[model samples]
Each structure stands twice: as structure tokens, then as C-alpha cells.
Target: MNFLIRTNWWKWLTMFLLTYTVVGGLLFTVPRLPILNETIRNLHFHVPMWFGMIILFAFSVFHSVKYLSSKDLVQDLFSKELINVGVLFGILGIITGMIWANFTWGEPWSNDPKQNAAAVALLIYFAYMILRGSLSDDHQKARISAIYNIFAFAVLIPLLFILPRLTDSLHPGSGGNPGFNAYDLDSNLRLVFYPAVVGWTFLGSWIAGIMIRVSLYQFKKDSE
Candidate 1:
């Protein structure tokens, strides 16, 4: 028990679990006011999932940059793990957003710029994984994958944020502007929402780290 507790993986897992519990508990206890009511509840899950997805993708791109500059195999491994986790969060975010939209907007999906952009972003990442698999050699695979990851992120910026703002969306701040800025979110919502984002982002990273460690262990065992 002592040995397990001392491990870095265990420490991260413990922290992630504790944070999740605290955030979930607080969200549950908070009274739903008239202004936000049910939409506010969506914040406890939807917004956090998007934040987690962004964090994972950011790390994936960072490692891709590192791999290009340093040619490190470990960086390549980290990039792959980050993408795997990012994709999971991205899918969750989309599903949750779809549910939220159905309640708030009267439809499960609108051609809303945000929705379209999010779908495009997911497809781009999927293409990245496909590009990695197409390569036969390890070194070549790492190099090409890193390049594709960087490009995927570059494309993601516009798809997720920029393009969404250019067109009108049935979603918030759609018709003439982007939403969720300083003026859009009230103080009460920010209280629980911000912490939720942090907690979920940490949880996402924790999962990715565990996956990376497990992959390393398996690789070592196979090599031996």
C-alpha cells in the first residue's frame, strides 16, 4: 500500500479522483436559480468536457513540436497518447453539447458554425491517426505523424474558434458575435464552471499519462 501510494501515477490518480468528487459534489448541492436553471447544470459537464479536449489537443501539438525539434521517441509517444485522450474528450464534448443543444435550441444539431467546426476538427484528428498508421517505418512514422499533428492543430484553431465566429450560429453569440466572453457568463455561473474546467482538464491529462505509462511498460516487456 505504501509503495503504491508513493508512485507518481497513484498520486495523480488520487488527486484526479479527489478533484472530481469535490467538483461533482459542489455542482450537485448548488441550487439552480431561475435565470440559468437547467442550462447551468449543463456547465457541470459540457463546458468541462470541451476544456479537457482543448487541453489534450494542446499537449498533443506541443509534443509534436518537441518531436520535430528534438527528434525524441518519448515525445512521439507522448504525442500519440495525447491524441488518443483528446479524441475521447472531443467525442464526449460533442455528445454532451448535442444533448444541451437539443434542450436549449429545439434541435439535436443545427448547422451552427460551432457544431460544424467541431465536427471538422474531429475529422482532422482522425486523419492524423490514419496518417500515422499508413507509415511502415518507426522513425518515418514518428516524423510524419508529428508533422501531421502540427498541421491538424493549425487547422483546429480556425475550425474550433475562428470560423465559428464568422457565421451566425443558433448557439450563443452566434448571429453577430462569439459567446462566452466576459459579458456572456454571469458571476454565479463562473464560480462552478471555472473549477469544473480545471478539474476535467486535470482528469484528462491524468488519463493520458496513465495510458502513456502503460504503453511504455508493454513496449519494454516486448523488447525484453
Candidate 2:
């Protein structure tokens, strides 16, 4: 795990997979579903962003738990940078989702259960950043933010995955709506979709890794 996080080889893989994802997503043949039709092509980019975001956030929470147990500022830094990249992916996911909604749902912003839930989830993380900024003591900031990070992820999982399903959500796999599985009867979408998820997730991790190394360097310099 540490080698995968710290090494540079997979960064090349991230680039290759993402390049393939973009080319294939834009030009690949997709199902000719009713409202989804050509828009179903968005499945490659849109769904992958959420998958990446969720993965990043899960990693952040893992580091946050590690920080709490070890009382290690480095673990706290890992949690912070992970959340930073995770939030970026979440924002991109929302933008892409809104674009898809405009094309398929006829509006950029509807009161869809999942949409609202996603927004709320982002706001919770936004508050996490705010909480970190509001503190001056490094240890205090790390300790509080680490706890908040764990709780934010707890809320995020239910908000994005569970609550939307319990209500009438327009999003696939939620409410009464059929997911990509139902539409992707031929397995064509999975080819690019799965790669897209891994590529985006790796890309986010790469960015977070860079930030972690930079922050650790600065921390060491300050301590010295």
C-alpha cells in the first residue's frame, strides 16, 4: 500500500488509462436508450468521478482514523491532503452530473434526492476545511479535523448511497430507477467505465501524494 502510494510507476498508468478513457468515452458506441441515448456516453466520465471521489474520501477517513490512533501529525497531513483531492473530485463530479442532468433531465439543477444529498455532503466537507482554517494550533487543528473527517465520511456514505435510495431519486440504482446494469446489458460501457474509475481514482491519489510530500517537507523544515 505504501509503495503504491509513494511510487511513480502507476502515475504513468494513470495517464495512459485516463487518455484511453477520454478517447474511448468520446468516440465509443453506447446504447441507444430513450432519454439517455448519446448522453449515456457520460457514464464513462460522470460515474467515474463519483467513484473516484468516494474512494478518495474513504482513504481520507482511513488516514484520519490512523492519525487519531497514532497521534501522528503525518497521518493527519495525509488525511488533510486526501480530503483536499477528494473534494476536488467531488466538485468535478457535480459539474459533470449537472451537465448530464441538463441534457437528460432538462434542467441543470433539480431537487433530485441524490443531487441535494450530494450537495449537502460537499457542504459538510467544506465545513471541515473551514474548521481546520479556523484553528491556529497545529495539534489542535489536526486532532479536531481528524475527528471531523471521520464523521464527515460517515455522513457522506449515507447521504450519497443510502438516503437517496430510500426516497424517490432520479439517479440510477436509487429509488425505482434502473441503474447502468439494466441499460448496459451488452457490457460495452463497463470496458471504459471501469478503467475510467481506476484512472480517476489514481489521478486523485497522485495529486494527494504530491501534496502530502510537500506538506511533510514543509513540516520537517519548520521543526528543524
Q: Candidate 2, residues 1-224: lDDT per residue as tens digits? A: 25666578899999999999999888888878788789888888888788888888888888888888989898888888888888898899899999999998999999998889889988999999999999999989999999888888887877777778788767765645446565553567788888888999898888888888889899999989
Give the per-residue lDDT of model 1 (tens digit) for 1-224: 11321357755654765476455634554545444455756766776777788888888888888889999877888889989999999899899889878877778898877888888888988998898889988779999999888887888887787777776666655655445662256666566666667667777777887788877787678668
Q: What TM-score would candidate 1 get against the native?
A: 0.83
Clashing pairs in 2: none
| lDDT score at residue 160, model 2, on the 0-100 scale | 77
Once superposed on the true structure, which residue ranges of model 1 sit more than 4 Å away at CA? Answer: 1-36, 175-178, 181-184
CA lDDT, candidate 1, residue 30: 51
- TM-scores of the models, in the order given: 0.83, 0.95
Q: Local distance difference test, per candidate?
A: 0.75, 0.85
